[model samples]
Target: MSMDVRDLGGRPVIIGAGIAGLMTALQLAPEPVLLLSRSPLGADASSMWAQGGLAASLGDDDDPALHLSDTLAAGDGLCDAQAARRIVYAAPAAIEYLARFGVRFDRTPAGALRLGLEAAHTRRRIVHARGDGSGREVMRALIAAVGSTPTIAVIEGFEARRLAMEDGRIAGVLASGPTGPAFLATARVVLATGGIGGLFHDSTNPLGSCGQGLALAAHAGAVLADLEFIQFHPTALDGPGRPMPLISEAVRGEGAVIVDETGRRFLDGVRGAELAPRDIVARAVWKHLADGHRVFLNVRERPGPEFARQFPTIASACKKAGIDPVRDLMPIRPAQHYHMGGVAVDGSGRTSVTGLWACGEVASTGLHGANRLASNSLTEAVVCARWVAESIAGTPAHRTKPAIASDRPSPDPTTVRPLLSRALGVLRDGEALKAAARALLPPAERKDAASDPAAVGLMIAIAALRRRESRGAHYRTDFPHHAAVARRSEITLEAALAAARELAPVLEGVT
Candidate 1:
């Protein structure tokens, strides 16, 4: 069914109402904009659930250069140095902007912003709000600010299923809302649809985050970079839940330790132990669990009884899981937390596809190379969102009659979650990746927009299989060491599908 796109007007349309989308809308204010959220604002967003604070060089002793250095080191040789530098230099001002939006950050006795430490950082520069509720607080402030802005129109409970293209530029978005399927016409579209963690059985992201943006962009012929590099957080609270609760790295910064069932410290041999880069720490914990040793994050003694006061959110989560951080060791395991890969974008958040932009976890801006620096995801979202908005502001609007695209039902995530979890979770091998790629290929071939999760799953598996060496978060057991030279993988969805077809026979008899 085709609908006229002219009804939706020429206002810029933003998708996914998380930090990135909200920030973009606010930045473009005074210039009319339309914002879309799959769920209610502040709900089901990884931003609100994020416990760690934003990373910025706000301290006198810290500098942007130092922050850039840490980010580069964490990226494991694949980071774009210029992008890292740009984001770090913009950090302090970004924090100030958030403050203007009414975000109350933790402060010191002297009235300066209080900074906390995280892994791989040379200085204490993590700015939080209410200890572990930084993301929630930021979202609360942004959501309130968005409500008062007269130029932004928000539509909640709508899922963007496809991007409508005309003459090779984005023209409109085909979405399914409470009123049923509808198409919104716009000259520009911004995709801030979070990460691909929902494809994993155990993840710290909301189930709705199934890489819809990546799939949409791929179907629109956008180039994707480094899709295999997924960061598995080391300390998600062990439990049976769709979205597992995370024990923020801030707890470790506050003096926690990871121990085995016998209370033996398993990370003692690694330099920096619990404070090591997340990739290193997660891999260590995964090895321990794979070796039949149960792991736990013990903060009962180091941080002591004040644990509840320091991290109220994590404390609450622990209590709900029937454990007290002040007295008991909390069971922990590695779970998929963030993606370092997505539709390739530049400094201004422009994707390879014309008239489309992406920010937050949905865009690979080269800040996070093979792995993301702690607390840097939020920083990238705000910085790139502002740039994207500014870039759009200077452009003239064009009104085109909307052309309708096929509206396919979104695929059930359950069909691909288990396969992805087994093949692309914390640890991976070539055979499993090949099988996953094979299993996911059919959906991509069908051109089913509903199979977005399967499309992204195939991309991740194919990227992981191609990168034969271990680097950062992507560890291939078959290729247990880093490559002699570091390089990144970039491919279009069409090319990936072609490669998948060629490899099908080779993987048929395996397993």
Candidate 2:
């Protein structure tokens, strides 16, 4: 296929179509933006799969301080206080912003926003829409708004392959589409490419979300923070599904209980019980599953018949699996649900790399710390999009010359899933991590489709190996306790390669 290069006259290019990407483009408003999406509008984006609502301190009894308190406690000491405070405080405004963009949130009979509760939240502050279809509603409105806005150019069916760098800054995006390779020459770029759950066999993220943004940034000399802190949702509807259906924590907050096959409510003893922080619940569930038992979510008495009315999406999934939530026990297990780490960004969503910014799950803004509070991911994305847009709008887009990029095969995580699932799941240890790193080194250095996914997996393995203490989602069986002092971990591709090389001296090929 022939390569096509087009200059957008220094328009800031947003390389995603999720909430972060859509919100940034909308906020940039009359300013032109080249919005790219690998799949049709909301078809394969993780944002469209989000069931839990966006977190905002919208209730009368709830306050941003209270929200921040819950956030910090869930973060387990790794969240940057300033970022978490700013984002949570701005959460209410974000909800309003979404509403202004045509998102009609669930409202009370008194014409106020109806708030729901989630795990680790002290008060009911989750603002949902269309019941459990919050993400779908948000995406639908944003996609419609984007279509009507003439300034934003929507480009679907194209995937960003690489960031074309000129003098150590972004000059253009090398992307591949159905026709051929196309390079959009623009000085500024925003990455909102979602999460890395696809790297695990049992994950809740779309399979297309295999850390493409992380790989793109890492290759362009960007730093990624806390790569090992992967949040596994404890109650994913378990079956033979590749990307498991998330039995949202909202269901649990609504009174559903978790139990093992013997009809024992296993989490009864833990503080907050099924409502504990996700990492804790996931670990408990994982250990139970490892101990020759089957775990299930029992909504029989809690939501009962209202389960279908309150959470129709989940109810449909249950029906498909031949399990009635009002009668049968819904089989469940822990699955990789979210990533609390990605291209390390500051308060303004600016990465270490100039002319580049990240948002959504692909950017570690330090708000999530070690574990994400339920429903905080969407809140963070909506809250950070404004800041990202402001930073981009304020900066002048530098002129860039036409650029050329080699055609690279699309990334495939098929070879990476099992390796990551084994080494970096809910439980980890030094030996498994080291072995994963060594095993991933060869493919990471290769030029095949598995390279990018392997490279992301390798970095995660290295990060998991380096963190000696157990903190939040990153639980190392060998180091099952927190360090005396809490700290966040950061990594670059170079550092990860160096660590991998040390593990496999004379790595199979490229040293």
Candidate 3:
């Protein structure tokens, strides 16, 4: 018996209810939006875990041009100038938009918004709420607003597995919920499915964020770019834990320092030391760890007593781990934090495939380039969400069609994680990447939603192998030198699969 696909009644359907998906749905109010969340909205989302706040030129000492310059510099030559400019210039307004939704930003004594500085920023322009609870506060406001909006119908605990296409255009999405599998028939499908952090063993992302969006888009023939550029954060709390706790960059901005076991600052030689670009800082921390030295983020000297008051979240997390930030040195290490690469989209968050749009971490909008500026992600999510909403609003919906459902078993994420972490983690070499490709590609044959992580993993490994140079977050130790020209890598799933098959001969006789 064929299960009838649930018709969304020509509504705009959004997958992954993070900051982007929620924001997009809210922006498209009165349009009857269908929003899907893998978990409850605000829970299991990177946006809700974001410690650092949104970056904006709201400070009197700052301006958009300065923000743009810092963004381009941090992007390491791949940032789209126009996109960066658009997001940066829209920062103040985006903040205002959030404020209107009842987001209570931390304010000064005079009732002015208090701004903080982060690494790579020229000015103190980061607008935070509840010190380190920016993501939580922002998400709280967005979730409340969403609940109040009658037009936005949220389906929690339902994960969108694959995008259904008809006649080379997006027809709807095939999703699996707690009940079983069902198809959602809608013309406009927006993917706000976050990043590929879950593919790594050590990541600051929820386990559910396993690059499903990337896989879904790629399977539907969307263009993916810069798959090699995974941003490993330098200060994930080093301990036995999955989805490691993050020590916000704002802690460093407040004058904390990274120190070795002997209290030696390893990043002293770097131009900005603790305040350098994340890639540089992460590499420095990684090398220190590889050298058998214990690395810790020392905040005792600076924000000692103020820690509990300013960053209640980090303070609470540290307390739970039996480490007091006011007295003990907090151990930290590099962990997979963000992906600078994802489903390629334009400024308006439109993917290569028609009727499919993307925003947030899932969509590579050429804003982050080779690396992302701290706190700029939230800004990009909001800006791009609004853009995607406006784009979808003006565009007419297409006729819904029945989607073909497949029951191919998903590749076990447990099996895929080790291969991806080994090959595509903080450091990479061609051999490990090739081996990972060999191991990951075979399982990618199961083209269902569950196999998207392996497929996305294969894409990253292959892309890393192809880009034989160190750039930004993608540091290939074998290719220690930067290429003469900086270029972005764009590939389709078909092309990556073809490349993987050609290397099959090398896989024989290897475990």
Candidate 4:
């Protein structure tokens, strides 16, 4: 049945004012936009934390076909090729759009977009600004451009609580204010809330990311896809912090190799080796670490100073961790950095929930299937958000109706954290997931954890357990083989929990 998109009133209520949110607002230029940011302007958004350059097919030697192929290969048979092609083909235009918006990407001596390399891409099409600061610069330009555009009404510090739905149609979001909760003037809602940081004990996502949008939508009955497939970068600096610091992919792209404590190159088996898909490399690093030895990354063999000069963020992080890029191999471990799956949406970024849309890390547009290729996060954000803006542009504007109270229960943190830590994060098992659900249940017949932050974490754990066969970021030790049919896994909390309990015995002895 065709959704009555007209009932939505189409003003595009966007949540989380990150780069994706900014781009979405700008793309629909001069429209009355209601941008809800959790923090003040340009504070803790994940896009500002990005270090890898933007991936595109902007070079003469590069094309979208190769970009699509690389993205698909990295996705390990789960990527929608049509979506990949469309997004890849739209790269040059996105870059041109950025250029028009005055994003000063890094230039060569003669000055053209100085494209760099990352894992999976066959060509050097990553456009950057200052070395390892493309996201920051991009945000600066986008923010300035959006601020100048008269129609946008920026309201910072109002974290979105839940989407206000009436009779199964999205009206607006009920958000919290400084004093108390208030109704956001919503016509149509767009979720660009970055990645999920609160789910993992160690993550590269900003602390502001708790997957609230995903949780709210899931609670509201939006069909989520590929919740199992969470991408862990093989090389996040394991250290003290709420969200662990990221080690950029540029290190590997610039020739850093992973070596074990015994000083043997463990990734020697894979073709493309360190540059292989993120899942393979991360697993290889995990396996090496499992042998009671820490895996270390070394760029000393290459021109160390040049590599350091090229990737200062990594160099500084390594240096702070007491490793010198010129002398020692940096101790590294695989940690959750990006989530490839989220609230399932169409090409136009419309979710199963009417009048609601999603873009950025929170929305899975079938672009990054099982695993996301490095640098595609930024590219995907621009591509998808642009589509979302355009799709909403023709949507008729209407005032959000009267607010309705939500029935979804909030979580008690004391129980859910350890439960989530045990089940989800970088490792997984079916048994652990089921146990996590049981252990996390409050004895009070609580409906609370149902909408908990850990609820989405449980969803990821359960979905990972359900797709028993090993594929991409989801490594199933019980079913150690890959499935022939690489279907996108979808589920609800109830179905996911049932599946979780069913296989609890299977994942019993595994972590």
Q: Pick the candidate with the highest TM-score.
A: 2
Clash pairs, candidate 3, are: none
For each candidate, what is the lDDT? Answer: 0.89, 0.92, 0.89, 0.77
Cα deviation in Å at residue 195, candidate 1? Answer: 0.5
Stretches of candidate 4 off by over 4 Å are 1-10, 404-415, 425-427, 441-451, 497-511
Clashes of 1: 2
lDDT string, candidate 2, 312-380, tens digits = 899998888899889999999999999999999998899999999999999999999999999999999
TM-score per candidate, chains pooled:
0.96, 0.98, 0.96, 0.91
The runs of at least 3 residues in candidate 1 whose Cα sits more than 4 Å from the true structure, single-residue gaps closed, are 1-6, 404-406, 447-450, 506-511
Q: Of models 1 and 4, which has the larger lDDT?
A: 1
lDDT of 1 by residue, 237-354 (tens): 9998769999999889888999999999978999988999999999999989999999999998878888888899988988888897878889999999999999899889999888
Which runs of model 3 end up more than 4 angstroms from their true locations?
Answer: 1-5, 403-411, 447-450, 506-511
Best by lDDT: 2
Which model, 3 or 4, shows the larger TM-score?
3
Query: For each candidate, C-alpha RMSD in Å?
Result: 2.7, 2.3, 2.7, 5.0
lDDT of 3 by residue, 200-272 (tens): 8999998878888898899899999888888999999999988899999999999999999999987889999
Q: How does candidate 2 fare on TM-score?
A: 0.98
TM-score of decoy 1: 0.96
